[model samples]
Target: MKKLITYIVIIAIFITGGTALTGCYVSSKVANKSGAQLWGENCNRCHNAPGPGEFNNDNWDIIGTHMQIRANLTKTEVDKITEFLKSANN
Candidate 1:
């Protein structure tokens, strides 16, 4: 009975530890993704995602600032998306 209980506790610890590590791995992968990927994933949720050519750099900066607030995006994410849009518009 004592050994059986010990095995169950060990198994439970492994399960929880594995779950935490899996989350960290997934988060790191997302952090490394490019702005285009992030834009495609997030922007289309509300409105149709526009072509990068639809706006110039200045327009993109204005739109990015507005969207960043409404979408609750981090400043870093907004900057990456803005830069990608500006580059692709050319």
Candidate 2:
């Protein structure tokens, strides 16, 4: 019983730590100038200036697919732009 409790505690700590780290990374990514510029140039061309949550989180995947078709972005650009959108949610 004690072992099981210890294991659960460890898992909880890891999950909490991971969430904190992800928050920091997302915040930094959103603040990055290159990311901001990319979003303005690429995303804003079509979107009104609301914010990421203007669409639901799942909508980002659909929007990214459309962007892939419309902009002919490389895989890296697509990934980075997706990350930028995700960061805005946090």
Candidate 3:
């Protein structure tokens, strides 16, 4: 009984640690992405991807705000995508 309990605790600890490390790795990967990469990955997930110059900065700002909610995107992602669009439009 004691050995079984010890093994279970060890397994639980490893699982928890693994999950934490994975989350950190994923977050770091996201942080390193460029605006263009994020735009391609996120916008295309729902409908067809829009051309970067399809809208002005103001327009992109509004769209980004909408998408942030509708698409469940992080604020950082939306900001990056919006910036990419604004720059491309220019």
Candidate 4:
């Protein structure tokens, strides 16, 4: 009976801990950030990013997709960065 109670407590702790950790992977809010800001915050954290003029809109889209995954960026961040690059490319 004592062992059974200990096992139940351990299981409960594991369940709660897992749920809490899961929140860290997901974006809590879509931040209102400029392209340059997002680029600096997310992209520059890992490596230097090329100037916006270096790539066309389509290229930015492709590169954004790849970087999104590589950087673990949220959809909102990807969209903002892509828009920023597109505007700056002009």
Which candidate should be chosen as best, given lDDT against the real structure?
3
- Cα lDDT tens digits for candidate 1, 12-73: 99989987876546577778879898788778988888878889899999999999999987
Q: Pick by TM-score: which candidate is best? A: 3
**By lDDT, highest first, what's the ranking?**
3, 1, 4, 2
TM-score of 1: 0.66
lDDT of 3 by residue, 24-57 (tens): 5666677999999999999999998899889888
Which scores higher on TM-score, 3 or 4? 3
Candidate 3 C-alpha error for residue 75, in Å: 0.5
Assess candidate 4 and give its TM-score to the true structure: 0.64
TM agreement with the true structure for every prediction:
0.66, 0.49, 0.69, 0.64
Q: lDDT of all predictions, in order shown?
A: 0.85, 0.69, 0.90, 0.83
Give the Å shift of residue 37 in candidate 1.
0.2
Compute the lDDT of residue 48 as modeled in candidate 1.
86
Candidate 4 lDDT tens digits, 1-90: 999999999999998998788656655443446778888788879888777778899999999999889888867789998888899767
Q: How would you encode candidate 2's per-residue C-alpha lDDT over 1-90 as one tens digit per residue?
A: 999999999999998998788654645554554644676777667765346566766787787777889976545556667667777777
